[model samples]
Target chain A: MSNPSPALVRFQTQKSLAHRLTLATLTGRPVHISQIRPSSPTDPGLAPHEISFLRLLEAVTNGSHIEISYTGTTLVYRPGLITGSSPGSGASGGVIRHELPAGCTRGVSYFLVPLCLLAPFSKAPINVLFTGSGVITSATPTGDMSADSVRTAILPLYAQFGISNNIELRILRRSNVGAGGKGGAGEVHLVFGHQVRLPKTVHIMNPGRVKKIRGVAYCTGVSASNNARMIEEARGILNSMTGDTYIFSDVSSAAYLPSKDKSNPNQKRKTGVGFGLSLVAESSTGSLYSADLASPPAGGVPPEDIGRQCAYQLLESVSLGGAVSLAAATTVLTLMAMGSEDVGRLQLGRDVLGSETLICLARDLKAFGASGWGVRDANTGQEGDVVVSVVGRGVGNVGRKIA
Target chain B: MEKARRMHSTQKKYRISDFARLIYDESLAPAEVVRKWRGEDGMADLADDHGPEEAVEEDENFFRKAKHNDDDGNNNEDRLIPKYDYDTLAQKWSNPENLESLRQRFTTANLMKERNG
Candidate 1:
């Protein structure tokens, strides 16, 4: 047979789409661009969302395609070991507007892991007081997400699914009290969050699957009255939740109240009550849910907006972490927020506020700028129910400018 | 020398940390803190030996009020009872002057949360 056709030499090859998916996987050093597409297309941005859909389709059919974005901000560092000085610049902000080529997979390898690692480092505990409500303006480009705005937007979703047997809600009000009496402009921000406890049978795909839930956050501010006498009265009113009394620290330690009672200097201030609410809900996704504001204090300015802003912020914080798999984070955050009692627990008396000085010995302690540290129980490490004194100091070069 | 030794034993240097520890331990305890500059061990010792000078009278008055006359267990228990209960008992021991009816208002608010969970 003609010498068996010289042992007919035929070569065949089978390639897999995993070469594309290699980029999306959380791994060190993404795949090289040349290995997959090996060539740059003339027009990459054609049908943007469709391209993503197609890549996803290819991933599902022929394995998976590594996803990359073209519209991201460009991040560049002067070739050196030193980390760049300004991380705030828009560089490396988002995926660019073009179709992420299979070649960009290599960049993904370098980027994804560090992002996952550093996400926790970006946020430290912050103690803020809501003095009044203000608009949360958008900072970045249109597409760039603003957490504060996202939080404000999601409050309706959470409120609609109110707290139930499976839900536990807690709210914290961070108000910025002013030096002037009540009429002085003060901002009050509300943080509302809830937790929903779920039974084991809900998630059967995996026995160890965690239950999912949602939280709401919002912020609002109101100007206090300038009447000094009323301000003092308001200041004397203790937080209904925590019996702690607050003193008005006027600008320049000046006790002059605009709404001062001419007869009695001590009666110059008015007190304002800041309100916060916590809400939590959990269910198997299609449960009809309903809720309303809990019994609020009778007749003063109702703290309706502050409560909404708080719930909004919490939801945004969770969403930024990830679209799904956010339940564990919500639980941890709820626990952290509820971990301590507010100043509301202490009954105010001059004797209780005795001249007590607390000298804290901080070794290897790190603090964000001006963040107040509560006097926690030394042995148990829980926050003490009472805050007798607060002292903090930091020194910076005279010439340094605060951003 | 014996008086000085006694003074020293009763006195303790007052530091913010020490006061903080005391305050955290119990909010009601009146802790006299005499601020001593760092490295001033001698001053600290002196302050410890002779408790707070300025607040001595105030301390005495407080101690006098806190002084319990008898160590009887029943007396202590009677004193430990809430003031509202004490006022009712004071009118007459075992007096059925409609005293027992007032005790129901002190029901615990968290009874449901603990029970439901």
Candidate 2:
């Protein structure tokens, strides 16, 4: 019932907004971010998608306070209690539904990344229904996160932390930007069961050799033939490296299409339709690395290029030679920093050591009173791998009931 | 116009530091700040030497130091732009020597006996 003290952490510009907000929620400490592109020439402020993200964060947390300057550059956030599914809380079973119309700007992975980190510590189960851009496209351009990448890459990484059984991420519909037709705005549902215990420590020293590669080639409003073409081209490149490669073709039926008939005025309007290719390679040690590409409306990049580019991206990720892909490593590290008081170690590609995402993650961890360190593995040397270790602050789910 | 210009300049003069202090004083809960400060300083040390009262003073000092350092850091530029060089990555992967180095990652290549055994 007593008020928690506030900590002032200042950020110079608009960077890692999601990580900053997520850490503030977990630590229950207010954050003050200033400057926020104060040096930009024109129209400088929080983007519309960032505002939508803030609204989504506010919708989930109870009694959270947010302040912004008139120019929308600086922001001050005081996070409220992270009451998940606790009874008598405003959210029932800690389940909340957020309808994001313009979510296409950032893609669902932007929100999903942080939600995955906070879900295990919620007082109750957390369920979210997101509707917007489902697959990454040129317009949405998977800015370091995408639904396909999250599903194919991140879920397996979470399993190593012992937080796997109750988590579900299902895609109800798929859509792309500027793909006009009957079915557009993608729909995805995520559910997380409450955690009785904090995440377990993990040691991923060697990501065994990749054994097989699998993928999903899906199409909506466009011709289903686009899916087949992508699969053929992608397999052509991957087969040279591994013979056991299978990319399945998936076409959404009319039922998954958004209701656009004038008779049903209240129904959500379809955005557009297109096709996409998502590929994931599984290593013998259960690590997953993934890549994806999507076609825009007619006159965009050719299907062959999309497929070839995706294949090369996968090759790039694999060649980095780590236990997990560069995309999922940040999520795994964030969860490790927020887990129980034990040391967590992971082997990541050398490239990730200098990534902006990792740097922001380190800053966010510091904000949460946790520290993480990365060093080259002595056995393999610099080019081989970078091992990161973090000792969790033992942050408990205060919202959970004592059984 | 002169009055409006004067108002704008005055607002800008307040600076981010002043706004941060205002938010900290008005929004932050006193107890949460101490707990966060102690957590950052390591609870074991706090438990050993000082009581909660002294921890509050330490928290204030931490805030002042944080504010002082905020003005000098120009670390935001690289953080805004992605650092991945895809062209170089493509070139590296295209190299025959590099491809040979990772041949063991595939199923056709022989797996290490210790791993499979």
Candidate 3:
């Protein structure tokens, strides 16, 4: 291709690579990210997980060009058309599958979250299966980035923006990594149907109080009793908070195959079992928030502690009192900015205003030309809520194939 | 006067070079530079550095907040609910006032006056 125009945006450091990439893909803009931990003593530049994430991005788009400095401290990305499916492949009803053995560093949210933003605009249906140890781990010590969070929190938030149908997330296997366990080995499947109907406006000003709680306690390659014990303890805590509480016990063996035989699981098993708990609380207005905890393979944590910890995390999310959890705000803000041309409004907890993720999101949105944005404290002058407004850029899907 | 305003509007269009300079400028810290770009003076020329101490502090805060999640041991106890403390949390939830405050979230609760009965 002819030499393209210079990059339209530049940032130093390694913050929000996923956000920047997603924005660039949507706007067809080139971005240069530099000084990505250039001064760190040991193993600076892009982490292994980041390189894996970039591979996923390159797989989805056509003609995308990614240039990295030899030192790995700088990156320049020229986005190609978001050809959701491989070129020349007509839209097929069968789900398009992409699998990644995500290194045990970052959780699947690192990839799944951006997919949630891009899938709706894809030309064909897409299914992603991420396998690794840290698929559920979050940057937040107490927060979770599990597939359950995507189902309970992220999907529901997308629904408010008129993306209710054609999306599903399933946790096929649960693997616990880190202390008291083997290492991160789990499996999650996410399917996105083609066609995301953009909303004309979003006005979720009030997130009603949580009404009920539900959850899944899952175990793989571990004792079945582990799942039951976790559910029992977690319910003991949730029951006191609300009458409507239910936690399910799920035991599956498909996620524990040895890495050598992951594809053909008939091979000898070489790994130990894993166990974890995931919880979701639903508010009266249909908002959902979630949390999860996993036990290490060797020095296992008490099932009761895992249960209680997950429950407390759910309670903390509810107490934050927003239509969506702080973690889900990034997706919310991105969708709002990408919606049809009109003002979209969201009432979020004060924590979102101060969150580095949201701050970076605001900066990225400005870079994308959605400059007419504002944040105002709630009218009551209380710390309860903050109202955020942004004018959508009316970004439509250029990759959608004509039926 | 009209010509000047029109010229200023055209210049307001964002360019990658501007963002690069804003970030790489050694004199002003990154956060301060970001603030200026987001401030009312959208694209005004950068001001001279305000000493190294302030820049260092602002830069540290920016990176600290950004790395909050990545640092495994840097736990923000204030934000996390203590694990395994079910009894106290359960008791807190059982409070009558607490239950009442959240009652509106249930279907059995009365609808707002704005909605028709």
Q: Name the candidate that leads on DockQ.
A: 2
Could you give candidate 2's per-residue lDDT for residues A1-403 as a string of tens digits?
3556755766656667877888888777788888787765665777655676787777666778899999989999988766554455445455566666542355566677788777887766777777643333222343443466577777767778887778888877765654331113667777877464567777777777788999888776667888888888888878878888988887863224345477986675445456677889998788887876666455367677677767777877787776867777777777777678888788876545434456556656765678645454524422446576778777656555233
Cα lDDT of candidate 1 equals 0.23
* All candidates: TM-score of chain A: 0.18, 0.87, 0.86
Candidates arranged by lDDT, highest first: 2, 3, 1
RMSD in angstroms between candidate 1 and the native structure over all alpha carbons: 29.6
lDDT of each: 0.23, 0.64, 0.63
User: Can you tell me which runs of candidate 3 are displaced by over 4 Å?
Assistant: A1-6, A86-97, A131-144, A178-185, A254-272, A296-298, A379-383, A400-403, B1-117
TM-score, candidate 1, is 0.17
Per-candidate clashes, comma-separated: 86, 16, 9
lDDT of 1 by residue, A1-403 (tens): 1231122111111011121222112111223222222222542221222233233223212122234345311111111111111122211232111122222201111111122111111121111121212111111111111122223222322332232222111122222222221111222222222322211111111111112222222222323322232223232221211123222212111122334467775655422222222223222332111111211223243443323322232222221121112212111111122122222111111111222212111100111112233332222111121222122222211111112
lDDT of 2 by residue, B1-117 (tens): 343344334432322222223223323333233233223332314225677776677678567656664663433432211333445545656667766666666666664753585
Q: Per-residue lDDT tens digits of candidate 3, residues A1-403?
A: 2446755588777767777888988777888999887767887788766777787777677778899999999999888766665435322344334444433445566678888788777666566666554454322233336555667667777667766676888766555443332235556777776466455478877676568888877776667898888888788866756788887777766344444546876765434256678788887777777776666445447887777767766765666566767767778888888888888888776544444456567777787677645666566322346677878887757664233
TM-score, each model?
0.17, 0.75, 0.74
Give the true-structure RMSD of model 2. 13.4
CA RMSD per model (angstroms): 29.6, 13.4, 10.3
Q: Which 10-residue span in candidate 3 chain B carries the lowest summed lDDT?
A: B73-82
Clashes of 1: 86
Q: What i-RMS does every model get?
A: 26.0, 12.5, 9.7
